[model samples]
Each structure stands twice: as structure tokens, then as C-alpha cells.
Target chain A: MNHEKNIIELKNITVRFDGETVLDNLNLTIRDGEFVTLLGSSGCGKTTTLRIIAGFLEPDEGEVFFDSKNMNGVPAHKREVNTIFQRYALFPHYNVYDNVAYGLKVRHVPKDEIRERVMEMLRLVNLEGFAKRSVAKLSGGQQQRVAIARALVLKPKVLLLDEPLSALDAKLRKDMQVELRNIQQATGITFIFVTHDQEEALSMSDTVVVMNEGRVQQIGAPEDIYNEPQNAFVADFIGESNILDGIMKEDFTAQFSGHTFRCVDRGFAPGEAVDIVVRPEDVDIVKPEDGMLKGTVTSVTFLGVHYEIIVDIGGFKWMIQTTDYAGVGETVGLSIDPDAIHVMKKSKYSGLYGDYSTFSDEMEEMNQMSEELAEEYAEELAAERTEEAGDGAEEAGK
Target chain B: MKNRTFLRRIIGAPYVLWAAIFIVIPLLIVVYYSFTGPDGSFTLDNMKNLSDYGQIFKISILYSIAATVISLILAYPFAYVMSRKKEKTQQIMMVLVMLPMWMSLLILTYSWMNILERQGIINTLLGKLGHAPLNLIGTPAAVIFGMVYNYIPYMILPIYSVMSKIDPSVLEAAEDLGSGSFSKLYRVILPLSMPGVVSGITMVFVPSVSTFYISQKLGDGKILLVGDVIERQIQAQNNYNMGAALSLVLMVLIVLSLALMKLFAGESDENLYV
Candidate 1:
């Protein structure tokens, strides 16, 4: 219902540091008054993108447009955007009032107006009586509020926050997250937030831009992205998923785990290899004969809201999160509803992958295992070659 | 745990004893000498000879202040540009700045004597260019030059270490908040780098105020400062009481300056390096 024209547009922005690509020809468009989140793990160029928009950094190649105006060479001070940095880089020398009044002072606003506006901002962030206190005297959450108040006082067209809540404790961080969303809605400013926390991104953003290794993996609404991930990385990164290798026979039918199952997918070549992902919460533990596959529960970890159960189905590991507790060493059956199975095109680390990451410990273990398997295969080939040589000599003697 | 704590305190006994013997006992002796006469009778006459040493004391204090200020001006930009370079480049600069300190100060001053005195390097080169010889050395300028050259590395090290610890996020935030380069430097960088500056001043000024050999060598034994006054009173005149009194006065002045700097900067010295 709140569709608006694009307020900012990034056209193929690319950035490199130390001869290594940090952002590879990335493009994104943000609508007016939209709360967009760039979600990724560390070193995915989310901070770099935010800096480019704030004019603290210039992309090596591509143009940035602010409301259809070219903004390539503009410095940060000249631009109308402000940023809330990580760790809340408040000036230790200034009190809270002067810190909030800084942007207006830069523009040479009137003395009375600056005070009134700073007071108004302090009240908005609920730090009304903390005007005369020094920045270092405030607590972490208080300092974070002061930072937000300082950035919001200027009423920039777009505000960039670089993991602003990352330094707070978990309870305070949750409170601040909700407070930030409310503030953005009240002020009606475009908020581009960068965080490595997926839950924070999904809970707060109107659009989530999932990035991996200098490339944008997907961009969509949170619900759509969660329900219909485009590839293996999205499926794995966003939430708990059991990604299994499967073969598509035709429309509405797929074969996986040595069993044929119904799935709501089409337009695939018969007997085509594909990745089928099902959310852990979507799976149900049923009777051993009533389900499609049978497995024994290997471990169950209590996760507050639910229990996370790891099952071994014919030497393949699958993680399931369910409210119903299943005892370890019990034979269980996993039943996936046809609509819950999401078929994806295999691109990178798709089939039978859990916690997909390029440089994670799991990935490193997989690499070593593959190397060992290759060594065993080479030994077998050498043994066959020697046997063939012996057989030829015997045949010639005969 | 209590026994372990007692053991830890026992381990520090040697340092405590060493400090008491070498530092505390000597300071007490100086204090005692400043308040008594050669006959061991309580007297104030030795400290009351202020008029005799006041002129040289004034000149020493003024010239040291000048040298300290000049060294700060030179070392700040040097350390700033150096700290902003690549780590390898900074390491190279570290070697270059510290290389001069490894040589003995006497040797270093004697070498400068060859460069600044008449028929020295500059005047010889000028005469070869068909110019008349100029009075080259034996002045306050040459003494100050030697002091500044010798003590500059002290100023550079403290400032360099502090500047490197400044968080990059703070500068970026200043720019993002619409501060231009000059305002950013004025409002943020300079205030944050004050700890470095004050420590640099302390290092340079303390030595400059008490130096006599640099002046004696470069000034050709003509000019004298408070340090020369102390040397004459103690060694040549054999008056330890007056020398101890003058040292106490100099220590008070240095301590007062340090207190003023700390009051203004309003920050503690957390990182102290020699």
C-alpha cells in the first residue's frame, strides 16, 4: 500500500580494497520511506555499500543516484544523508546536547533553533533530562540513543546505520531494534540498515538484500524470501533448512531419499537433478510406516522455544526443529507436505548442505573429506591397472 | 589464596628496597642539604642567593620553552604523516627517527660543532662560493638547535603511538555529520591527540631546561644557563647547599607546568613510554 518512486539508486557499484573485490558490480534501488536491510555475514561489503551511499567512499566503478541526480563526486558533508556508525562514535569532548546539535550547527542554524531542535530530538529518543551529561558518562543503550537522535535531528532524506545495535546486550538490542523501526515509521525517512544478524534483518526490514561473497544472492520481502529462496545459500542462510538432493521426474513429482514424493514444481527436464529445501518447522514426525523416510534421532538440543533434533536417515544427516520432543535412539519418520518442499536450481553448495558458507569450519571439513575420498579412488584405479596388466600376460601365455 | 597473595608481595621486595636506596635516600639527602649549611647548622642563606642566579635561570627557562614549542611544531606533522602511512613505511620511519638517539649525545653535539662553528661546513661552502665568512656559532640559536635536534625523537614517539590508536570510525563519523576537513581536524582529531602532545612536551621540556653540555659545546663556553649555575656551585665552588636549592626550584617549576597541562587536557596519561 506504500509504494513510492525510487528515492535512491545504485548502478553497478563496485569496490575493491587491497586488490581484493569487496563489492562486485552491485545494483539496488530503494523506494521512498522504505526500511531496507543489507543482510550478510561479516566482510560481505554491506558496510562498504552504506559508505558509498553516505559519500564517505566512492565506488571504483558505477554511478550513484539520489532522486535521479548523479552523486558520484559529492563529499559526505555536501550530501543530505547522515550515518550512525558502529559503536556510536559520539565525540567524547562534547556533551549530549552539543552532539545532537552538531549537524544543524554545521549548517549555521540559529542559536535558539539549534537548542529547541536538540531538545526535541532528545525527547524523541526519551533522553530528555540527559542534555548536560558528557557522552562517555552514558550507558551503552543511552549512547546508542544519543547517536540515533544526533542523526535523526537533521531529518536527512536517507539515513544509513552500520550495525548500530551490534554493541548492545541482547535484551537492550531487541528493545532498540523495535524503537528504531518505530522511529523510522514516525519520521518517514528511508532507513538503510546493515547487520550480520538475519533475525534482526527479517524482523525489521521491508526488503532484505541477502549478500554473499561480494554478490547479492537475493532481494525480496522477508516472507517471500523465507518461503521462496532462489538458491541453496539463501535457503541455508535465512533460516533452518534441510536441503536434500533430489531428482525431478516431471511436473508435481520428485524423487529424493530413495523415495518418490509429490512436490508443487514444474518446467524441469525429466530426471533432472535439483535441490529440495524444507524448513525445519514444516516437517512433522509421524509413524515409521506412514512417513516417506525413516530415521533415528541422533541428538536433541533444547532451544528454549523448541527442541532441535538431528536425525540420521540412511547415513544422511538432517536437522529438524519441532516443539514435540523426540527421544534419542528412537526411530522416527519425517513427513514433508507437498507445498512445503521448495525446489531450487543447484548453483553452489545446494544439495545435502547444512549451514552453507564459503569459509566455515563445516566447509573446511567437507573439503578435507573430499580430498581423502579422491586419494582412495586413485588407489583403487591403480590396483585395477595392475590386475589388467597381469591378465594380458596370462592370456598371451594361454 | 591468601598465602599466594603474600608471596606475590614478597617477590616485590627487591624493587622496593632498590627504590628506597637509590631514589628515596638520594632525594632526602638533597632536601637535607638544601636546608642546611656546610657546618651542619640549619640556615636559609644558601637558598636566599636568588639574585645571583636569577638571570641565567630566566634565560634557561625561556630558551627551553622556545625549544620545546619548536620541537612540537616540527614533530607533530612528521608523526602525523608518518602514522598515516603503511605499516612497513611506519616501521622504516621508526628506524630513521630512532637512529640518531643510538649515538652518544656528546658525540652528536661534537659532530654538530663541526657543522656550525666558523670554518665549519656552511661557512666553508659559503667562502668557496666567494662570500665573506659569517659568525657561524657560539649563540643561543646554536644551543637551541642542538637541543631541538637531540630531543625531537622523544616528542615523536609518544605522539606517534597515540595517533595510531585513534579509531578510524570517529573521523568517518565527523565527515558523515557534515564537518569538512578543517573542522574535523579542529574539533575531533586535535582534541583526541592532546594526550600525545602533552606527553611530548613533558619529554622535550624537562631535558631542555637542565641541559648544560650542549650549550657549552655549541656556545663555545661563553653562554651559561641554570644547569651551568648548578655545575659551578656544586663542583667548582663546592657549595652543595645552593646547588640542591636551585634543583628543588627547577623541579617545582617543571611539576607546575605538568599540572597545568593535565588540568587543561582533563585526561590521564594511560600510555607512558620512554
Candidate 2:
């Protein structure tokens, strides 16, 4: 990104909290007027990144620059940036008008201008008539809107929101997510929002930076992140992915799970082991003989418009989606396009034991143990029901 | 259920009856006496008599108000520092504030007497600075100073309690909104901690009004507050009816002062009570 378009650049930032490194050598460039979301699961340091940008936490290793200005020693209050906290920290003593007018008042804007700006901001949030109402009297969504209005009224170059809608109910959260995106676009300010919900991030952000364990996993547009994940973590964290371990055979053919398949994602040495990730919706169900792989249908689920099928292919369970009917215990065929097969270099963090062969052996043993535990629990439940029935029968006879 | 509730009420009735007898009945008696005359005749003479009592009442009110105000001004910073400091420091400071509270009022008054007297350490130090012994004892200032010193912890504790409950996030939010430190103090900290301020004022004022011991002791038996007047009328002069009427009048004044304070302090009293 060009320096003019990029409002903030954080390079090689590292943060350690009580000897535990929370953010480690992270670099990110936030462009101007773009709604970028730091999307990740819990313990992902996404919140820490937002806090660091807000100047609440200082990095131990690197520098943060905002519009070519260094932000090394600037306190949060002195920074040009404004933050909307998760709790919507509205001044409880101030009503809606005063709360909205707070920043302008601090700036010593003329009274008439403060009034006009607050009124204009309130109208933007559709809270025009609520000037005299106490902030405590507003609903959760209203308070969040007021918080955003307050931050925006300051005309800050960068607006940082730390899970602003996480406190609302599901329906309200969804509504505010749309409202927030519209507000950001209309205001044309850089929005650095933090959220643990992948769905929210994917739906609202122009760009999503996925993070995990104090590191950036991937940074891309929603479609790019969803369609072409860079690694197993990105593929697994963003959405449901079925991974199959395979080996390249120098002829563009991959072998795995008792089947051979062609792959288009090349540039790998022959005999190199790789993990192939295929979305459940990408799997094609066809005739048993025509399919590249055959499996027994273990379960079929009707989820609104789509049908989800769980197939057991030679003791390896794979989730597949198909519109066709596949009953339990019936053998089915599954096929995938070579282009749809995403190949990732197997990672060390997957905790796979020893070599790939040992990994497969351990997986089989784990599956057997799980099955035996389930059978044992099921028999115990049956025995309890039988004893209760016997007691009822004896009482009836008596 | 009705019988069980009745039984529970019966078991708890003695404490309630005791409260009514000791607290409510005496307050009612004070009210009654304030309305009666010296000759056992029902009249508002005691309430309206204010000729001798008026000047004394004014002096008493002025001295007490001044003392309470000064005490609050002095106690706030001390209480704030104590409340904001580390746990061990706060505890030690609190114990020091509470030491005067644990000591008897009469003993503390004598201690003040020794400190404020002509040949006391303060005067001796001033004399060492090439000045004559300054007059401090046997004055209204001494009386006010004694009351304030004795009752300062009463002011500090309630205010500290209120200040400690104020969420630090509220102040940070104010700062984030671009409020300077002074504005944040005036808007957020002061208003949010009003309950403590109001309660501290009440704690200082109510007792200081009828506090005759420090006045009589420190004033060298010359200053006569309402409490002193009532004590003298009943014990020294042997005029029980006049004493009762004066006591009743004093009670009414205290109640009115409290009501006025509440009305002025605005909506925070109910929150503190709850």
C-alpha cells in the first residue's frame, strides 16, 4: 500500500505481558477510508492489536506510524485517534446531547457550531429527537450508536472500535453490523474494527486480517480469504474445511485415503506430502462407479436449502454436501474437481505424530477408542432404562 | 402461613418496640417540649422566644457551619489520597483517622486544650520565633477547631466510601472525550462522588450543631450553645420545663438543617442509602 493511502503502518510490533509474548513481530498497514476488520478466534491478539493502535498498549519491539507521524510516546488522550470501547463508555451524567457534544466542547468549538454538529451527528445515527434523553435510558443499540456518533463527531482520522456490537442480541447485532458499515462508508473514515466472529467480519469488512496466536494468519478480501486460504489454520479458522493428507507422484496425481486424484496446484517436488483442503460444499456426489472415491453415508442432514452428508470412506470420515438423497449405510460416490483441491504445505503446528504414516495410524487408533467409549456409554444407559422398567413392572404386579 | 408470620412478628416485636420506646418516643417528646411553655402550658413560646436564644443560635449555627466547611475542605484531600493509595497505606491512614474516633470525646478535648493553650507547644514555637504567646484557647475559633478536629474522620469515611465506588473508567472515558484534567474533575469526579460529599457534610454538621462539650470545654465555660443552655437550665438552674423546651427547639432545628441539606444536595442521598 502507498504511504498516502495507508493511514497507519505497524511494523514488527511485539508486546509481552508478564513474560508471555502476546503480539510477536506483527506488521499491518491500514489504508485510509477503508473498513478493515481484525478477525480471529479468542486468544488471537486481535483485541491487543486494536488496543495498540489506540495507544493503550506500547509495543516492545517496533514502531507504529500514523500518516507518517510516529506514535511512540503519545498517550491515548493526546493521539488524534478516537476509540469506541466495547462497553460504549458514555458519560453517565451527560444526556445524549452533551455526550455527543463532549469532544467538540473539549475542542472549544463555538457553542452554535457544537449544537449544529451534535444535531447533525444524532440525525446521522437516526437519533435526532433523543437529545434530551439520558444515555442510561437508551437501549443497547442506541448507546452503541451514540458511542459511534461521539467518536465520529471528533472528526478523527482513524476510528477504532473494540467489539462495539458484541454486547447486543443476535438480531440487533446483525442490524448494527449493516448500519456500522453504512456509517463508515458515509463518513469516509478509516475504521479498524476488532471482532472474534468470523461471520460478522466476513460480511462487513472490505478487507479482513485474520490472526491467530499473536500472529497474522492471512490478510485479504473476503472472497480471497474464503476461496483460497493460505494454510491449514486459515482454512480451518475461517470456515469448515475437510483436510486430506496426500502425496504428489511427479505426474500431477495425488494419492490419499485409498484413492488417487489429480491436482492442479503444482510447484511442489515429487513425493512431497501435502494437505488437500476441500470445502464441504465443493464435494460432488455421483454414481458409485463414476466417483473418484467411494464411501458409506453415515449421516444425512437437511439444513434449509442444502443437504449435508457425512461419508465414511475406508474408515476416514469426510463431511460432504450434495442435493442427492443418500441414506445411512448406503455406499455413495464423491468427486472433486482438480482445481477445487487446495494444496497446503503440511504445518508443524497440527501436532501430527511422527511421520505421515504414523499420523494415519494414530488417527485410526483414536477413532477406535472413541467408538468403544460411545458403545460403553450407550450400554450403560440401556442397563439403567431396563432396571427402571423392571421396577415399574414389579410395582404393577404388587 | 398467617400464623407462622404472626409468630415471626411476635419473636421480632421486642426489638421493634425497644426502638420505638428509645428512639421514636424521645424524638416525639422533644417535639412536644419545643411546643410547650415554661409553666407547663402548651404554647409556641419556646419556638418563638428567640430573644436570648437567637444570638446564641446564630453564633452556634455560624460556628458549626464554618467548622464543617473547613473540616470537609481539609478532609477531602486526605481522604482522597488515603482512598487512592496502596492497600497497606490506606489501612494505616484509616487506622490513624479512626484513632480519635476510638478515644473519648472528653479526653480528646483535653488533649486539644493542652495543644491550644497559651503555654502550649504551638505558642512556645511561635515564642521561639521571636513572637509573644498567641491567644488561641478560650475563643470561638478554638471551639470550632476542636469540633472539626474531633469529627474529621466522620467526614472522611463517608466521602472515602463514595469516592472509592466511583468507576475509574468514567474518568478515563472523559479523558478519551478530550476533557482536560480539570474539566474531568469538575464534571465526572465531583458529580459522581456527590453522595459522599453530601453524606460527609451531614456527618460533620448534625453533630457539630448540638455539640456543647467541646464548646464549653474549649470555650472555658463561657460559650453557651443550645446544648449548653439546655444542660445549664436543667442541671444548674433546675428549670426542667425550660430545658425540655430548649432541647425540643434544638431538635427541630437539627431536623430542619438535615432536610435543607438533603434538598440542596439533590438526588444522591437515596443512592447512598440504598
The best candidate by TM-score is: 1
Stretches > 4 Å off in candidate 1 = A1-3, A355-398, B1-20, B31-45, B267-274
What is the Å distance of residue B85 in model 1 from its true position? 3.1
TM-score of chain A of each: 0.89, 0.86
Question: Over the stretch A42-158, how does candidate 1's per-residue lDDT look in tens digits?
Answer: 998898899999998999999999988999999998898989989888877678998899888877899999999999999999999999987878999999999999999998999
Candidate 2 wrongly placed segments (more than 4 Å): A1-4, A244-255, A285-302, A307-317, A321-333, A352-398, B1-20, B35-50, B74-150, B157-167, B213-225, B228-239, B267-274
- Give the DockQ (2 decimals) of all models: 0.32, 0.31
Could you give the DockQ of candidate 1?
Answer: 0.32
Proportion of native contacts present in model 2: 0.48
- Could you say which candidate leads in lDDT? 1
List the pairs of residues colliding in candidate 1. none
User: Candidate 2 chain A, which ten residues in sequence have the lowest lDDT sum?
Assistant: A350-359
For candidate 2, list the clashing residue pairs, or say none. none
Worst 10 residues of 1 chain B by lDDT: B265-274
Evaluated on chain B only, what is the TM-score of candidate 2?
0.88
**Pairing residues by index, what is the TM-score of model 1?**
0.88
Docking class of 2: acceptable
